[model samples]
Target: MTDVTEEFRLNLAHIDGPLAIATLTGDLDLHTAPGLRTGALEWIGQGHHHLILDLRGVGFCDSSGLSALIGVWHSAKQAGGALELAAAPDRLTRMLTLTGLDSLLTVHPTAQDVLSTHRPTADA
Candidate 1:
């Protein structure tokens, strides 16, 4: 992969069943938030109500990113599903906690936790 690809800012991988993953790298800020919004909506439209965002690779995130996260959370809740974040950086975790969204959104320790701890919901 070239340096640009290696510097991946974001990626979304849709899985069967209810869960989909949004992997991010570089910085998740205002400039890149639109992409996140679009990708997340696509998965939601595809019947993936449950989402696990693997944010370990993300090096930075501002309020815009947090807005996107909240957007996903609300979208899932609206669709009768849940959106979880896996392995978020300390800063992101702190941000979510400070914003009081931590209690609203689910969080896991790792990507593996997404599968291992997943419980098939009745709604989605």
Candidate 2:
């Protein structure tokens, strides 16, 4: 059988405030995981204190990709920021749940939820 290959794309957009969103497309395997990590760190380095990963377009993810995510989460926390995943695929969610990482990594139903939940209160 011939081998099939997938292209990975990571796109970042900064919202009106301190929030930045990274939209990932294609498979998130060992080859693509580095791109995701680089994109996220680039945004954080740009002074974005809050990050949301939009994984709706991600069709596949392997252990390496998940490990990269955990690393990114640690980077965010060390920078005094937070990382959240929005619209993660069912398979990814199940993996996180089974591995007990669902609690460590915040998962939101939608990007809007990420914004609303992390948005700074008026009093703050």
**How far does residue 62 in candidate 2 sit from its true spot (Å)?**
0.3
* Model 2, span 1-124: residue lDDT tens: 4322378888875564556888888988888889888888887787675788999989888898899999888888887778899999999999999999998888999888887777853222
Q: What is the lDDT for 28 in model 1?
A: 76
Best by TM-score: 2
| Candidate 2 residue-wise lDDT at 110 | 88
Segments in model 1 whose C-alpha atoms lie over 4 Å from true places: 1-8, 121-123
Checking candidate 2 for backbone clashes, the offending pairs are none
lDDT of each: 0.80, 0.83
> After superposition on all CA atoms, what RMSD does each candidate show versus the true structure?
4.2, 2.5
Candidate 1's displacement at residue 62, Å, is 0.4
For candidate 2, what is the lDDT? 0.83
Q: Which stretches of candidate 2 lie over 4 Å from their true place?
A: 1-5, 121-124
Q: For candidate 1, lDDT tens digit of each residue in 1-124?
A: 3222234466775475777777877777777777888888888888888888898888888888899889988988898778899999899999988888899876789878887888666556
